[model samples]
Target: MVHYDERTPHLHYAFVLVVFDAKKDRYKVSAKQVLTRHDLQTFHDDLDQDLKKVLPFYEKGILNNKTLTFENVAEIKKNNDQFKALKDELANVEENSNDKKAILKITNQELNEVDLAKKQIDSFKQGCLKKHLAKP
Candidate 1:
């Protein structure tokens, strides 16, 4: 998970959203989202509005007896080390890849890094969802 540090004070937790295929007992992360107390008011407002769209389900689940866990509203933070590493890699690529061919290769490497970041975020979101939705 991207954790908070000196650079980002707003990040606080992690979220994980997973979609399971019962027939296969396999799951995939469909989305990764986050919430933070720094924007708690806005977040709650948005959450309330979203819940309104699914009022029936909310009434049946939450209003009856179900409750959402703190896991549902987790925080996000920045990893300075990770950011530095990425920056260093990009700097190295820029320093060495002056030719078009080398630049293209470096660009692909950057793309891979971006994809990895996306997957990491997705995994965190899925984890949060799993915890939030877990039933007693």
Candidate 2:
């Protein structure tokens, strides 16, 4: 049984009751209901009482290995956090790689311009040499 409504803007109470399906090897919701602001307290109290009655059966199922335990929830959370960190790290590395590629492209363009300038200077010097030699 889970109660959640924090993400929504409306002031409503929602409850979900999930049961383990041994045949399907998965958990399924057996019942779910929502209570508006008007009936929130009364419905919630009734739901709590119903859940209390089923609590012993749920516990018995866990003790008999018929139902899953929540011991792996913490591990799942840790793995999710690590996965997010790795995803962020990958994004950073990709961004840095893109920056490096842009820098390299600019550097290549500058080098080409420098080469062209050097060629022009050499051509000018050759023209001057020919002019002076012809006079001699």
Candidate 3:
């Protein structure tokens, strides 16, 4: 889903991990089997290549982040935790601040941070879309 309800819009993709079971003659839900090490390694690169096929203006390597690498699961989780804390703090700022102008400025900055954290988290999550097109 593409979210337009924010300062900077972002996309969210939800999926179920499934793999073919040749012996069983059917597909089975198996995240362990589907999310392989190789898939994690090249997921973003592959996605960028696939996106470029239909999106003329979309640039290759758009998923690459200069400050954060999605490969570090621990780092992503840490940042997510921090993001949550920051959001809670932003809420406090909105409630406590008396100056509307100051509140607006602070809210705008926090919103930008919210957008960045969302992008980072979502980029890490795109690995789940192995061979499926996420429904918008």
Candidate 3 clash total? 0
Model 3 over residues 21-99: C-alpha lDDT tens digits? 9999999999898788888677777877988997997763446355366667888999999999999999989777757
Q: TM per model?
A: 0.27, 0.49, 0.43
Which has the higher lDDT value, candidate number 1 or candidate number 3?
3
Q: Which residue runs of candidate 3 sit more than 4 Å off their true CA positions?
A: 1-17, 53-68, 71-73, 99-136
Error of 2 at 127 (Å): 0.8
Best by TM-score: 2
The 0-to-1 C-alpha lDDT of every candidate, in the order given, reads 0.63, 0.68, 0.79
Give the candidates in order of TM-score, highest first: 2, 3, 1
For model 2, how does the per-residue alpha-carbon lDDT over 1-136 read when each residue is reduced to its tens digit? 3335544222234558777889999988765333344453355456556766878643222122342333356977887899999999999999999999999999999999999999999999999999999995
Deviation (Å) of 17 in candidate 3: 4.7
Candidate 3: C-alpha lDDT: 0.79
Q: lDDT of candidate 1 vs native?
A: 0.63
Q: Comparing candidate 1 with candidate 2, which one achieves the higher TM-score? A: 2
TM-score of 2: 0.49
